[model samples]
Target: MIKAAESVGIRAEWVTCQNAGQLMKCDALFIHGTSSINHHTYRMARWAERERLAVMGDPQSIIRCTNKVYLAEILERAKIDTPATIVVPRGNAD
Candidate 1:
């Protein structure tokens, strides 16, 4: 992805935990890893958005996509077929 971006004359750098501080210098952020609300990638995305940097996998999307129950509800409402699913409440999984 870096190579492709550079090919188009768009300066890009791979940000990792070691060099995440460099994110402040970037014009945009493209996360290339798994993202969840409790993960570092999510924090990075949130920070990027807070700093007004263009970001893929924005915080809101991450929040919505990471919650399985929310996704199930959305799919069901949209009439999208899915395998049988049961959402058992925590501590009530008897």
Candidate 2:
């Protein structure tokens, strides 16, 4: 991936993206997925939003695939109840 970037004269910087400090160095993020990230990464994503850098590709594809709650929300919104759900802490969140 870095090689492909270098081919186009674009410099790729790899850093420990724990927050805006990391994303602040880049102009954009072509996020292929979010399966490998933890909660801290979400904070970085929020920072990216605040910083106004472009985040490409389907973030949900990785996020929802890794997070059960998020995936459930997508399914529910699509009216596709693919899982047997029982929300113990179900409240008037909606």
Candidate 3:
């Protein structure tokens, strides 16, 4: 993705949530991959939100996209097609 962006004359730099200072320097933010709910990336997203920065994907959207339960709710609300889904207790598969 970075290569493609750069090829199009878009200067893109790779950085992690830990590099929030550097990230803020960029014109926009792109979270290339998903992270656990407890990940620091979420905090970074929150920071970006507070700063009104141009985030490629909004923080709330990122949270929803990363969590199956939330994603299911969104899909159902939008009447989008999705395969049958069932959520069982964490420890009890039965």
TM per prediction: 0.85, 0.50, 0.74
Per-residue lDDT tens digits for candidate 2, residues 1-94, read 7789999999876544534366767888665334344654555555565678776533444465776777777788899957587444557556
List the candidate numbers ranked by TM-score, top first. 1, 3, 2
- What is residue 68's positional error in candidate 1, in angstroms? 0.7
Ranking by lDDT: 1, 3, 2
Best by lDDT: 1
Q: lDDT score, residue 20, model 1?
A: 91
Error of 2 at 11 (Å): 1.4
> Which window of 10 residues has the lowest lDDT sum in candidate 1?
11-20
TM-score between candidate 2 and the true structure: 0.50
lDDT of 3 by residue, 2-91 (tens): 999999999988878556688667777777776555777777777777887777666787677888987887798899999997777699
* C-alpha local distance difference test of each model: 0.92, 0.62, 0.77
Q: Lowest-lDDT window of 10 residues in candidate 2?
A: 32-41
Better of 1 and 2 by TM-score: 1
State which candidate, 2 or 3, has the greater TM-score. Answer: 3
